[model samples]
Target: MQNVVIIGAGQGGLQAAMSLRQEGFEGAITLIGAEKGLPYQRPPLSKAYLKTGDADALSLRPASFFEKKQITLVDGTHVEAIDRAARRVMAGDRSFDYDHLILATGTRNLRPPIPGAEQALDLRTLDDALRLRNALDRPMRCAVIGGGFIGLEFAAVARALGHEVTLAEAAPRLMARAVSPETSERFLALHRDMGSDIHLGDPVCAVRADGITLKSGTEIQADLVLMAAGVVPNSELAASAGLAVDNGVVVDTRMLTEDPAISALGDCAVFPDPVTGRAVRLESVQAATDHARLIAKRLVKQVDDPYGAVPWFWSDQADCKLQIAGLAAEGDDTILRPDGAVFRFAGDRLSAVETVNDAKTHMQTRKRLAQGPVARAALEAAEFDMAQV
Candidate 1:
């Protein structure tokens, strides 16, 4: 391939460019991003960036790194359409030809159809974090929508900054989609202990100028409202180009789309789980960077190996850090350990492991799961200590 053009200069897109060079693919690499300036990390936008308000600290790489690597970065450019027939992408009047196209378009915040939803601020980008930091400058009443990682992380920081935080969740438990009920309850107590008003099973009916109203007719008066209601994949460009898109751009185990010339990665690509063979989409930095590296190897080194990297994720709330070693289905049976590590089982087979402030156990669980499915009886014999097994 002489030229590889990547869309969306976010974490995954930037990684594809870097990985291409690392794999010795000396092609014309162009990283196109809708946002201006350097590509920064999004995970910290909800964590340290809230407290420190340091924009420079969130940068993934310096401008010098891009220049030294001979990577072309086109910032503040929105991709209008993809011409599959021409093998080129049009950004307004400009068109760039590509030997291979990588769609790392990522995702955007999902704004619900609530009244005055636009009034609520977002925390998906550095610009949003900067706005949230400015809003948290004063001791304002902060009403947060959603009890997921972003909402809880923001609540912890807001409370630490001496702001009254009221977090509302439609689900019965916090992080219901990601974590087990036991782990969700644990975080609920942690947030409550930190002086946050945690409301479960209460969906925000409407977002007003001042605050939000719950479905149970309870209104939260606040000077600032944050929309942490999750995100939607950016797959419209790929869809317009006649690519199959379910929740995201549908890619195979090799991260290649139906068209051999195109591939998708990061939050915008939905591929089958290597363990389950079920369609799954991951939004972690690990998944994105790993997909980028694998794609780079296939393009540069002609490796035919499928993407089977073990999925893992982490969230920082207050002083507690919740980590998951593998991807657990929504209704997996969770077995709790004495030391507070939660093991999820799917039909007598280990699916995932959840731990709080336990890095050793987390790593061990990931290592074990990677070897293949562990029987429930074997785990019980080891007293649920993955390190021992």
Candidate 2:
């Protein structure tokens, strides 16, 4: 276990390199990523980056940090295939041997088969965000193709810039896959109040130079179209090598894949849900960084504790900062608080908590969820403060 090679230069990949150093791994480490430059945070690409075009702030660490940490970074490289028998990864003509391989390949934006969808712009990478920011320099009519966090965040920023914004969601609600209905309703109200024309249950049939046409025959006139529909995991690399891949590269509770020398993490890895036995793939800084830490500990110090870190996420739109702690399964019942906090429960077990601009409650929820499930009666009686327990 001297050499560790990580494919992908995203947050999770970089975190694995850093965590290995922190865990006292003096072995050879190589982090290969297709993206150029250092690993940066993607959350702000839709939020703050859209508003100010601040690229430097998104960097996880300075360039000097990587050199000082002795983490070999190979940027602008694509890992075409994995030679499982040879125990080496082939990036073009170059071959890198590894004692252990980590697939932090992450995910890519899902482009649906809609007419003229090819004309829609993407905001997944730094260059994409820069292109969008330059396009938004003037007064332009903007139509976002999704109602998810990224789409809504861009719409909010575009609206703030005095642009005419029309957000289209194929689903019945905004952020349909992530937050609770109550939280979604709140965010929907906030976006609408900010003068963005939000259309729900309306799928974009086509994108024209003028605007987007919905499935209901309604046409939205806009100068620019943003595609933030969703993303699919980049698990083809592992699947090609005969590894199990569900929604993502399937891993065990310890973050190890079918092969002992191989592991997966972040939005690319489908691991067991800490709360349930169900397999889950989470695209968040929390899951990526936590999984990296767990993998590093297991490899460096042989710390074999099961991966059970509490999941959390945050979205910034307008003046509202929505934060979520824990993972709630579908069909989870949500208990709404008077202060706009939504607590999602799976039967008697507490699953997740959604808070708007409430950092105190968010932190408390994460802390409490780490201690495992709490009774419904105790939570209802203990009031809003989980710390009060």
* Candidate lDDT values, in order: 0.94, 0.92
What is the RMSD, in Å, between candidate 1 and the native fold over all Cα?
Answer: 0.8
What local lDDT does model 1 show for residue 239? 95
Worst 10 residues of 1 by lDDT: 380-389
lDDT of 1 by residue, 161-225 (tens): 99999999999999999999999989999999999998999999999988899999999999999
- By TM-score, who's the top model here? 1
- Compared with the true structure, what per-residue lDDT tens digits does model 2 show for residues 118-199? 8999989999999999999899999999999899999999999999999999999999899899999999999999999999
Q: What does each candidate score in C-alpha RMSD?
A: 0.8, 1.0
CA lDDT of 75 in candidate 2? 94
The model with the greatest lDDT is: 1
Q: How many residue pairs clash in each candidate?
A: 0, 0
Q: Candidate 2's C-alpha lDDT?
A: 0.92
* Cα displacement (Å) at residue 48, model 1: 0.6
